[model samples]
Target chain A: MSEKNHRVSRRQFLTYTLTGVGGFMAAGMLAPMVRMALDPALEAAGDSEFVSVGLSEDEVSEEPQRVDFSIELDDGWYSSEQSRSAWVLREGNEILALSPICTHLGCTVNWGTNEENPEEFFCPCHFGRFERDGTNIPGTPPTRPLDVYEVEVRDGMIYLGQINQRG
Target chain B: MRWNENDAKTYQSAKEYVDTAIIPLLPVAGGKEQEEAVRMGEFTSYLTDFLERQYTGRVYLLPPFTYLKEESTEDRLERLKTWTEHFKNQGFSHFLYVTSDSRWRQADARDLGELVWIPAFSLAEMDTNKRQQSIEQQAQQIIPLMTEKWS
Candidate 1:
């Protein structure tokens, strides 16, 4: 009876070892594909990278200056770098970065283009006008203020993030 | 305003504000070298695109006026005059005729607003940076001319 029990224990050990090794091998083969399937989803969620527009705190002035930067965008199967522009101004101790695109018809607006209103942002298209603080002129075509960007200052360098519509 | 449906829709409601129209004059020469003529057409379209982007809402970009290269200047001017007349009826006061064809320069078209003559550039062979620089420079030169019309 003792000899029969020893033989049964040996068979059980062999079976358990085979099952453990086989499971590890199968997982090893499936690991890469599982990671590949999840890669884009992870990237989509991890796209909050900030782009430095190459402006230091001192370079920022009260006058609105054009700053161009490029950002990496991943749209499912395709990925590309897109260039964008913004108008930045320093008001007192605050740094204000506004989108150059007009709120009315998506035209680019220039700072101080109108001689009569040197302090305002002027859009050549449709005569859209915005106040110095990016508020749309009451009687003008633009119904909303210009969009602002998320900003970060690190070691005297200014970085800009996603554009946020003004409330 | 552009020829696109979206811009056209915007134009319908804001007709009074859009007083300017740009008519790109492109010459099509039929021959064995059709490719070169096509390149010129593309270049002309590119320049017009830059102008449209630079002055988005104020100017309407009309479909290009393409004609035979060998067509008489007088005939072309007559067709252009009719087009200008139609645009005027639609409330467009400023008609800008943008062309690389120098023949239009000799035509007396003061009544058709400004005639902007841009020197032809070989855009087909240019790299992206060079092409952008050339377009930017041309746009810069044209801005003063457009602003003068506005004032």
Candidate 2:
């Protein structure tokens, strides 16, 4: 309405707009850091999903047998890892799924035939011997059993879920 | 409400209904990697289960025909013939073959008293949004024929 009143109102509007623009610019600069902080929380919400092992029940051996399988796991967009393990034995109708990871130290275990010892799974890292049931023997360096997967069979196929580490 | 809004009460009711009324109607088969396959195959099987459970008067649940990898056509034929003979002996009203493999040709469609060849839909063909629609369509087509033949 009045010239002085109009001038004062225009100055107030400009001040508010500049402050809002500055605030937006600051947020834009810090957005990456904010995302990085919240990344773990987002991952936890969707982490460790169940994956198909692609084995037919008929294919699994009745005795303590080694079945090697690999599954692709995604950590994020940047990387993918191939997780390979040997599932041991189908006890009756249920499966005893074991991870061939050395418990003494984290090392990949191999199934090899020792002429003296017959065929057994051996961890070369510390010379750990795991039985068909994945139990570490008394004299071996490994003090714990191999990891076990929660398994379920439905529609003539197997699915493996989270792994439980032995104490 | 929002487009993706989930009503807890409605969701719970639907889940309870599926668990109690629909799941028992399904023939649960077990195999290696079956749990995973079932998880993937649930969408298709749900339609079959729903129809068998809810429309028992008109629809019959058929036993699944197991597919084996064979080397010779003779072996395949023998297997198929044995399946048909088994069904007939089991007193099944009609027999149907569902397979995703297009290479399987029904040489003897009329061997059994009533046999229908239904192609199994691939996982890629039915996207997530269209899964239920595809199942419903398949059920409508397959169920009608079985009813017409056996009922």
Candidate 3:
């Protein structure tokens, strides 16, 4: 009676072993493929994200300076170099990298270019204004603050990454 | 904004902001100066593209006005007048006719549109890096002009 209770059918034993081995083998084959598929999405956000804007941490000042840089753009089948610019400002240890793109009309805003509104980001088109900290002043064309870039300081050089939106 | 499917929808929703129109005046000569004409076209179009990139929501880049080098600016201005009139009727408040053709400096083409004539040079002689740098520098200067117009 004890033997009968412990006994396993040969078919059941074979099926269990095969399923366990096959499942592990399938997972082993798919693990690298899944990682490879996710590799680019991670790369764009990881160490490969930061690009030097030809400025160093020491070069950053209180005033927002426009820094132009180029990045390799991939649109599936084709790749090209896309020129991009950002407004870099440093206040104490917290550095800020503002996207030049205006929130309202997508015009490039210059730092302190407007005669009436000096010491602010002024959009040439539609007279939009953003404060030094990227806050959109009320009664202005832009409804939201300017986007900011992720920053990294490597060897005292300023490197910038993807743009991030703020509330 | 542009004459593309995606931008067309954007323009429809934001018609008021897109008040300016840019037309690249391309020179296409068929003979000895053909290469120069192509270079001018390349350079002017690059500037127009840069301008569009800078002010995508406020500006609309129209298809280029490709003309033969043999045609006089006076004759071309007559055709461009029609273009300006048509776009103006469509509610464009400002028009910028940009080109690397120096002939525009001597051409009496006022009242048609604001002519932005940048002097063209041999870009082929430049390395890729220098060429891009020079073009971007020229484009940088043009951006202020467009902004000034808006102001």
The TM-score values for the models, in the order shown, are: 0.74, 0.40, 0.81
Q: Is the docking of candidate 2 incorrect, acceptable, medium or high quality?
A: incorrect
On DockQ, the leading prediction is 3
lDDT of 1 at A129: 90
* Highest lDDT scorer: 3
lDDT string, candidate 3, B116-135, tens digits: 89977777688656777888
lDDT of 2 by residue, B45-114 (tens): 5555534532332223444444333334456556667766764564444454443333345445466433
lDDT of 1 by residue, A31-58 (tens): 9999999999987645557789999999
Candidate 2: segments with Cα more than 4 A from true spot? A1-8, A45-47, A58-62, A73-83, A91-94, A105-127, A150-154, A161-164, B1-151
How far is B55's C-alpha from truth in model 1 (Å)? Answer: 1.8
Q: After superposition, how far is residue A98 of candidate 2 from its true place, in Å?
A: 1.1
Classified by CAPRI criteria, candidate 1 counts as acceptable
Q: In model 1, which residue pairs have backbone atoms overlapping below 3 Å? A: none
- Interface RMSD for each of the candidates: 2.0, 26.7, 1.4
What is the fnat value (0 to 1) for candidate 3?
A: 0.67
- Judging by TM-score, tell me the better candidate of 2 and 3: 3
